[model samples]
Each structure stands twice: as structure tokens, then as C-alpha cells.
Target: MDGYRGFLGLLVSALLVGFLSVLFTLIWVLHYREGLGWDGSALEFNWHPVLVVTGLVFIQGIAIIVYRLPWTWKCSKLLMKCIHAGLNAVAAILAVISLVAVFDFHNARSIPNMYSLHSWIGLTVVILYILQLLLGFFAFLVPLAPLSLRAFLMPLHIYSGLLIFGIVIASALTGVTEKLFFALTKPAYSTFPPEGVFTNTLGLLILVFGALIFWIVTRPQWKRPKEPNSVLLQPNGGTPEGVEGSMAINFGKADSESNNEAAARKRNLPLDEAGQRSTL
Candidate 1:
């Protein structure tokens, strides 16, 4: 089972890398050929997809799977939780910057904001994402929320997270489609340019990557497991299950040794084996 999970993990990695590769290919072929900048230019618009792909798509997926990583098992749960929250925070920040860049570019061009289907869904998802981060932090990271509340909200958090991830990917695909339709003039926009093909491929990879990540995260078999004799950690220091099991086995061995010694003494044949006793 573990081996299979490991193989699945490799598949997930490949899918994620492919997603980023396709995304970068689109960006380079369509956007970066012009150059990148933060000021109010077409170049500035590139940040939106770059940050969304790097932070929301790539880093975000990595953040979601921190607990699933086998090496993380040795570390304290709280530590992993911290890394989880931190990665999420970084992604959220980048996503926000992406949004800002889009709005800024639109305003500079005297274009309307939140007017398109892509913008509507994108903005809503971003708002929901920020709220999700807040809920997660309070529920799991801090004692701000009651542990009961945290437990109650946890499943909802997981469910909503996967759903929102899907929504973001969908919005991104639409946004890319919209960009190709609106922005491109050269290479004849209607005649299926190379950039158009790459953009569609990027969108497909996003779906595949999202599915793989969602699968690995939700699968019960892939979840972290406590060993049979795994020790439980507590503030006051507790005895390990492995030590308890070992002690019981040692006690049984000692009892068997004592029993044999007593039987040998009772035989009283120079305290030797049956062969020596028979010879004597």
C-alpha cells in the first residue's frame, strides 16, 4: 500500500510539473515575448498569470500536501501545520498581488474591472480564499476557536478547499481564453495561433494537475498512519507503546529462563544436560 502511494505521489509530481511547464510555455510564447514589468503596461498584466500559476497553482498544491509527505511524519504536527499556514499565506499574498496587477492594468487602460465572467468568478474566489485562510488559521493553528469548533469545521475546510481550487483553475482558463481573444492582434487571432494551442494545453494540464492533487489529498490509503506501537505525544511526557510491548516480552523471557533454571536444579545431575547425566 505504501509503495503504491509512493508511486501515486510520483504521478502527482509529474502532473504538477507538467502543469507549470505548460503554463510557462504559454506565458513565454504569448506574454514574455513582449517583456515583463510592474508598471501600467501590457507587460504588467503578465504578473497576474505568473503569480496565479506559481503561487495559486504550484505552491498552493504543495501546501495542501504537506501532511501527506512521508518525511513530514517525523516532525511535530504543529510544525507541519505552521509550514502549511505559511505556504498558504505566501500564496494568498501573491494571488492578491496578481489581482492588484489586473485591476491596475485595467484602470490604466481606461477599461472596466470585474465586468467579465472571468473577473466575476476570479474576484469571488479570491475573497473566498482569503476567508478560507482566516478560518483555517483560527480553527487549526491557534486556540482562538474551540477545539470542538475546529474539528467541526475541518471537514468543511477540506471540502471547500478542493472546491475553491477547482474554481480558481476554471477561472484561470477562462481568463486566459479571454486574454487571447482580447489582447492578441498579430498572428491573426481567429486563425488558431501557436499561442492559442499552448494556452489550451496549459488549461488542460491545470485540470489534470488539479485532479491528481485532489486525489492524493482525499484518498484514505495515502493519509499519514500511526504505527502499531507509535508513541503518543503529550505535554506531560508519556510512555511509548513500543516500550510497553517490549517490556512485556522481556518479562515473559525472564519467566521462561527462571523456570528452566529451577527444573535443571531439581534434576540435580551436576546441573548439566541429559547427555552428560546419561554418561555419568
Candidate 2:
């Protein structure tokens, strides 16, 4: 409660703005500049920015933060995991289709591929995003790795995800600007035409959304509180014997729990001399 007061509301508004802004930009592209479809025409290229912004950047943001939502607190950890994995999977599929759209458009027009900064960054982000999703699925979803392995990787995964998200948003912003210039050059983009203003505003909104997401996910105080008394239920409709602590966190280092009292003193979290987590 101490840490959640102001930030959650900020997250909700940020999410809405980010999502709507992306949707607006996609519509703007399809409606005014290039109508969306996959007929291997210039119009087909429009689908790339739309899907990458919506799926890779916007939808992916929600997937990463689903666990932080207040409504998810009472839900089982397994349920949240499923939601996370499923959202990410859908985002990845959309990203793939968007990439295909662009490549097809380029090939049809004899345009060389990966020439711009935006393309390079977008491709890199997608590759890394796919890798991250695969690793996360095996590590956290199935519990295939040792607790220590998951522990070491968890921080990396979170940090890399945030980084990838930022890069993707940045790339999308540049892409939007580029599209505005090339597609609306009848009056010139430097004159601050309506298209320019609208696209730039959409890009700025995406930036704001990315900032809020990073804040919500990385702020130490925003971390979900442990449910100390939650029982670990097994698949056989029975509680795991002698297992009576929060399974809220996945893949905590078992060896470290043995030392929570002695050496597990982390900022914003404390452990008693008995190795039990302190409520404070």
C-alpha cells in the first residue's frame, strides 16, 4: 500500500494515452496516406508501422505489466503467467506479420532492405524480443531451470525487456516521422502540415507511454507484495505438503531463502533473523 498509491493511477492513464495514440497513428496512415492491406503495393507498407507500434510496443507493454495491475493481486500466479505468455505470443505474431508486410512491399518495388536507421533498429528489436520470449517461456513458465538460474535471469529479462521496449518505441517514432515526410511531401514536411503535427504528436504520446511503463515496472516499491500465507497447490487437487508460503513470485532462489535472515536484506524488503520476510 505504501508504494502503490499514486503510481498505479499514472500507469492506467499512460496506458490509455499510449494505446489510443498508436491506434490513432495507424488509422491516420491507413486513412490519409496509405490504406492498409497486403497486396504488395506501397499501401501494404503501412501495415508495418501499424502492427509494430500496436503489437510490439503497445500490446507488449500491457503484457509486461499485467502482474502489477491491482485486480490481478488476488488471482493465482499461474493464471497471471498464462496471461503474460499469451499476450507476448500474440504480440510476436503480429510483429512477424508486420515485418512480412514491409519486406513484401520493398521487394515488389525493388527497394533495398535494411537501409534506414529505423529498419535496422526495428529488426534488431524484433529479433531480441523473440529471443526474450522464448527464454522467458522456458525459464518461468515451466520451471525447467533451477531457482538460482531463474533468479539470475529474472533481473536481466526485466531490464532487457524495458530496453527493447524503449528502442522499439524510438524506432516507431522515427518511422512515423519518415513516413510523414515521404508520403506527405506535396506541401513539404518542414512546413508543419497537419499530417506532420498529428504524426509527431502520436510519436510523443508513445514516448510518454514508454516512460510510464518503465517507471511502473522498475520502481522498487512498485514490486508486488508477497502473499506470506498462500498455500502452494499441486496439480492433484491438493496442497503441497509443508509448502505454505507465497508462490506469488516465480523461481525464487531456494538456497537464498535459507539465508533470508542472514544475507537477504534488500532495500524495500527485509527478513527477520528467522529467515522469514518482514511485513514492514
Q: Pick the candidate with the highest lDDT.
A: 2
TM per model? 0.75, 0.80
Q: Which residue window of length 10 is worst by lDDT in model 1?
A: 232-241
Model 2 alpha-carbon drift over 4 Å, by segment: 3-5, 229-280
What candidate 1 gets wrong by more than 4 Å, as runs, is: 5-12, 15-19, 22-33, 226-280
Give lDDT: candidate 1, residue 58.
Answer: 70
lDDT of 2 by residue, 1-280 (tens): 4556677687878779877877786778776765777799977888887788789888898887887787777777778889999999999999999999999999999989999988898899899999999999999888687555776798898888888888888888888877786787778889888787877888888888888888787776766665646554443432231133244333355646756755545532533433553443
Residue 24, candidate 1: how far off, in angstroms?
1.7
- The models' CA-based lDDT, in order, is 0.76, 0.79
50-104: candidate 1 lDDT, tens digit per residue: 7887777777877887787777777766688899999989989999999999988
Cα error, residue 49 of model 1, in Å, equals 0.6
Ten residues in sequence with the least summed lDDT for candidate 2: 237-246
